[model samples]
Target chain A: MEKKDGCVKPSKGVIQTEETKSAAEPVQNGKETQKMLAKVGKPAPDFELSAFFEGGFKNVRLSDHKGKWIVVCFYPGDFTFV
Target chain B: MGVEVVAISTDSRFSHKIWQEEELSKMVDGGVPFPLLSDAGGRVGTVYGVYDEDAGVDIRGRFIIDPDFNIRAMEVLTPEVGRNVSELIRQVKAFQHVVETGEVTPSGWQPGKPTLTPGPDLAGKVWKEWKPEMAFD
Candidate 1:
């Protein structure tokens, strides 16, 4: 992917169909077997994953927060000294 | 400040619960004030290009996504170094400023600082309007 005019070009034509198919499943069990579609300067790849929030477990989808800025942080593991 | 934050890892929800209660809660009053997501088998991480298949974990990385769902900036680093929260906040503010106004921020630009208008006339004349020392001030 290349950055142009402050936006990254998205990889074309392969993400939509796969995303739609995955969306059909009510819950994703971390078994997503599709190609990576995320590119910097392009729409973030849609995802639905289980999350522990507010003392409870709930499913969180990336698309749910449309129209709001989001910060997605990835860490190696929990309880690590980092 | 109208931003939503989430942290993802290969750990299960159960593990997140323990860590939140035993560790994160001590760092902050009520622990991290955002969702602790479980990516389980690195499914989500793989899509973001941060998953380590061999290590079975996601590396340390962060992405700032705009309200339009477009990724504006991303940072990835090795485990030895911790990410800086101040820099993240600064970048977020810069992005918001650019979105609100069509001006681009200079390096280390903060709120209330002068911004540059993007155009051909402003290209070479940048040195006249903005100085190298301004970035440090």
Candidate 2:
């Protein structure tokens, strides 16, 4: 079982839901997901996050690609589920 | 015609770098065509609804955004399921075609395939507009 701690190593492509959705509310748990994002057919939420660049790190933002098509994918983690 | 592919995760940039160097070398022939954004604190993932609080990781999610920053298409998959890159490419191409030509592709549409224009007269005869060919796999 992968603990909810950020320090623990992740296994490849292993998926586990939360023990209780109640615990994740306000507290946030990785098991239960809330499908409430107002994204489809609307504007995407603009976000700026760090990214692995050419042998370095760079901040990437959603608004940066305003003039181009953007394919945004969110995977689990490195060396884990890709 | 221009598309920017950005991947994100809760992992730190250092972890992403190491993973790219060690594991992705074999999988990616030349290199990663796009930048892998690091959502280190899971803020972006939470907004995108792909964040899992239990495992402290993100589920597989794909969003196709157009040039005007509009969300054209999005898919959220379970952690166990892998995404189809070929299908994504096809969808991107489809979106591009529609934007350029104002025509919509039918089911199983691929490049060079016939498309449908939305109209009442062309509605019932959609079968006549598109002919199936054994081109796309």
Candidate 3:
């Protein structure tokens, strides 16, 4: 992928997980992974995860926020510098 | 501006609580004004293609999902650098403009700036309507 300003490409040495490995595989005989992975211009995969919100833990589902734009960010870990 | 922001990491909720209290609160007035999600085992990250199984963590990434749940933009980068919040907000505004006006935003486009109306007439004549210097201004 081409690197743009304020964005760096993931290292080539990074390991791909099993799910991604299967998803990345070239289609053969018209068979492909049934699971839908998040991609630009495609519907985001839905997920329900626990969250720490307002001094309490709560279950947050992506679909629950339908009809509103959502910005989902992921980081390596907590307590680490941004 | 009606966007819901959430952050996810492999850390547990307890860790998020402590981080918010001990670190984030000091930076922001009352800690980040968004939900700090805990993605155990990187399941959510796996679907987003940002999980690092060997490291047991999700690499730093961000996604802008439209109201319809379609991913309009995504940024994936290593942890060495922090993501730019201004750029993220800019793109969100640009997307919102396109959705409302059916006009395409040019590079570095901002609100009240020139937007191109997509059609055959504006195809090759883009330079006549917008100039490269306009992006910087």
**For this target, which candidate reaches the highest lDDT against the unseen true structure?**
3
lDDT digits (tens) for residues A1-82 of candidate 2: 5244344323222111342223234534645443335367777777677667777666666777898999999898778754
lDDT of 2 by residue, B29-120 (tens): 64587887777556667767888888888789999999887899998998788899999999999999999999988888888877789989
Tell me how large the interface RMSD of candidate 3 is: 3.9
TM-score of chain B of each: 0.95, 0.88, 0.96
User: How well does candidate 3 reproduce the true complex, by DockQ?
Assistant: 0.40
lDDT of 3 by residue, B99-126 (tens): 9989999987988898999999988999
In candidate 3, list every pair of residues with a backbone clash: none
| Per-residue C-alpha lDDT of model 3 across residues A1-82, encoded as one tens digit per residue | 4344222212222124464466654776896323337899977777777778998776688878889999999999998877
Q: Give the CA lDDT, 0 to 100, for residue B54 in model 3.
A: 93
Ranking by DockQ: 1, 3, 2
Clashing pairs in 2: A18-A31, A29-B53, A29-B54, A30-B52, A30-B53, A30-B54
Positional deviation of A59 in candidate 2, in angstroms?
Answer: 1.1
Worst 10 residues of 2 chain B by lDDT: B128-137
Q: Evaluate candidate 3 and give its CAPRI docking class based on DockQ.
A: acceptable
lDDT of each: 0.82, 0.75, 0.83
Off by over 4 Å in 2: A1-38, B130-137
